[model samples]
Target: MTTPDVFMPRLPWDAVDPYPFYAARRREGDVVWDATAQAWLVLGHKVARNVLAAPHWISDPRANQAATAGRFFTADTVAANMLFTDGPTHDRLRHAVRDVFGHSFISQLTEGVESLCKQAISTIDVDEPFDVMSQIAWPLHVAVIAAWLGLDPAQCQVLREHSPAVIRLLSGITDTDTLHVGLAATTALITEFLPAAADRRAHPRDDLLSYLATAPELSLDEVVTTAILVAVAGHETTANLLGAALIRLITPTAEGTRLADHIDPADATVLTELLRLDSPVQAAARTATADQQLAGVHIRSGESVLVCIAAANRDPHVYPAPHQFLPGRPGPSPLTFGHGAHYCLGSALARLETSTALRHILERRPVLTATPAWRDTPAIRGPHHVPARFTA
Candidate 1:
C-alpha cells in the first residue's frame, strides 16, 4: 500500500488572520493533501463545488468515526437532518420542510423581518461605541426568527442566552462540558416547544412552527430536530454574515460603498459577491466513502476532507481580483451555503434577514464606520466586538 503524498502544514487556528494562509494554500493548487491533518484541502472554486456535489463524499461524520470522534462534532448531538444525509433520506426531509421554508414561504416574512430590523436598529446606541454583534446583529436575527416561528418574546431571550453557547460549539470554540451544556439547553428548548407546537397544529396557527407541525411524514423527533435546526442555523449563520458584511461596509474602501449603494436590496447576486469575499461558514468537512483520486491526489476511504469555502470563493483563476470585494463582480455564487442537495434550507430566510439589517443600518446610520474585533472561531467567521459610532 503506497502512502498518499501529503502537504503538511499547521492548521491556521492561531493566526489572527487566516485569509493569507488560505491564499497561500490556494496558490499551491485546487486540491492539496494535508498530511498533518490527515485530510485533503479543497481550495479552488471548481474543486470545492465538485467535492460538495459528489455523491461519493459523505457529510455524516459517522462515516469516519476515528477522524471526527473528538474533533469536528460530537456524535450524540449530530442530528440526522438533510444537512447530514444524502440521496433519498435528504430528499425526504427536504421535501417535508420545503413548504415551510421554500423561497415563496420565506418571502412572505420579509415585511415582518424588516419591521424587526427597524426595531432593533432603533435601540442601537448611536453616540457610544457599541458592539454591533450584540447590539444589532444578534438581536435582529433573534427577533426575526422568533417572530417567524411565533415564539414567545420571553422565550426568545432564553434562546438568545443559550444560543451563543451553541454557536460556540458549532464554531469549534467550546470544550466538552460547554458543548454538552449547549446541546442540552438547545435540546431542552425543542422538547418544551415541540409538544405545544404539536397542539397548535391541531388547532392551526399562522406561523412557521405551525406549518412545520403539519408535515405528515415527519416524526416528533424530526419535528424537534427541524425546529432546533431552524433556531440555530437560521439565526447564527445570518448573524455572522451580518457582522462580516458590516465589517466590509465600514472598512473605508470604494468597494464597500459601492456594495452599500445597490438599488435592489433583495438582489441575490450582489449578496453572493459579498459572501464570496467574506463567507461566514468558512469550512465544512466530508468523509470519503471509498478511496478516490481528485485532482491527481489520492483520498483514502474513511479519511475526512475539509472544503475551504472561503478559500474556494477567492480562487484567482475563477474570480478576478479575488482579494478585492466587488459588489458588481460577475461570477458563480459562493458555497457559503453548501452546494448540491445539501444546500441550506434557511438560505432565503438568511438572505432576507441580512438584506433587511443592512438596509436599516445604511439608511439610519450612513456614517457607520469602524474596525471590527473578529471572533476566534474556525468554522464561523465574524466580528466579536464591532465598535461603531453612528450619527443620525
Candidate 2:
C-alpha cells in the first residue's frame, strides 16, 4: 500500500460527539495518516492491538523529535515518567507498585470503596437534579485514592486543587500561560506537597507514600515523580469511567433500563462490555523504534502512531451491533485499559471502584434529569456535569 491509499481525516479534537469522526476515518481504512497530527492513526481493532503489543513500538517520545516538542517539561522529566519509558526502566518503575494494584490488594479495597460509594450516594437529594460527576464520582474516587496514599485532609485538598494543573501539563497544551501554571503546579507537587507527605511519616507506613518514598531501589526524585503519577492517574480515569457508565445506566431506553436492573456489579465480563461501549481514555501514542509494516502499511523509524482505543472498541469486525450497550456481549477484551506491557496498573482498582459505585447507585434507581455537558479533553473523554435524580 502507498501513502495515497491512506485516508487523512481532520482530528476532532473539540468535537462534542467525536465517535462519528473516528467511524468516518475507520470507514476509509484503519491505518490512515493524519497530516494535522503528523502521526499514523490506528483505528482498527486488530491493528491497534498489534501496535500496542509490538515491542518495536516504543512509548518514549524522545525517540521522535516531533513527539517531544510543544511540551513544557525538561527532557529528563519526560524521560522519568514511566508512562513514557520502555525496557528495563519501565519494568523497574512498574514492578515497584505492581502488587499494589493486583487482585489481592484491590479485593481489600472493595469494602472501603463500597462504604465511600454509599456515603456519596446518601448525600444526593432525591428528585433533585445533581451533577453526578462532582457530587458522586469525583469525590468518591478522590477519597479512595487519598486514603490509599494515607494523605491527610489538608494534603488531599492540595492534590484536589492542583490536579487540574497537572492534567494540563499532561495534556500537552502549548499555551504560554497554561504551561506556566502547569509547570508551577508540577514543581510545587514535586518540591513541596509530596515532600511534606513523606516527612509526615516518621517511619515507612503501610501506605503508597511510605512505599514509594522509602523504597531502597528508588531515588527521592523517582519517588516524588511516581507519587505524582499515582495521584493523578489514580482517580482521574476511574472517575471519568464512572461518570460515563452512569450516563449509560440512566439513559431512558429499554436496553438501558434492562442493563441497569440486571447487570451484575461483580461480573467482570459485564463491566468489560461497559468499558468497551464507553471507554474513558480514548487514544494512546507511541513511536516506532524501527521501520515496521503495520496492517500492510510501512511505518518509518521515529514516526508516531496514535492508537484509537475508542474506535477499536467499537469496531464492527470485533463486536456485532458495535454501538449498542450489551452487557453480556462476548468477544476479545476491549482496549480501554490498553494492551501488553503498558496495560494500566490501576485497572483492577478502577474496576472495583466502578462496580462498587454502580451497585450502590443502581440501588437508588437513578435516572438522568438533564443532558450532560462533556469536557473537551479529547484524549480523556468524560462528562463535566451529569445531572441525575434517584427514584428509589
Instruction: Judging by lDDT against the true structure, name the best candidate.
Output: 2
Give the poorly placed runs of model 1, Cα more than 4 Å off: 1-11, 14-16, 66-79, 125-128, 168-178, 201-203, 253-268, 366-370
| Cα lDDT listed for each candidate | 0.72, 0.78
lDDT of 2 by residue, 58-139 (tens): 8765554444223445667765688877889888888888888899988988888878888999987778777888888888
Clashing pairs in 2: none
Worst 10 residues of 2 by lDDT: 1-10
Evaluated against the true structure, the overall lDDT of model 1 is 0.72
lDDT tens readout by residue for model 1, 6-63: 3322245332366887877766778886664556788888888998998788777556
Best candidate, TM-score: 2
TM-score of each: 0.87, 0.91
Residue 310 of model 2: what lDDT?
91
- lDDT score for residue 269 of model 1: 63
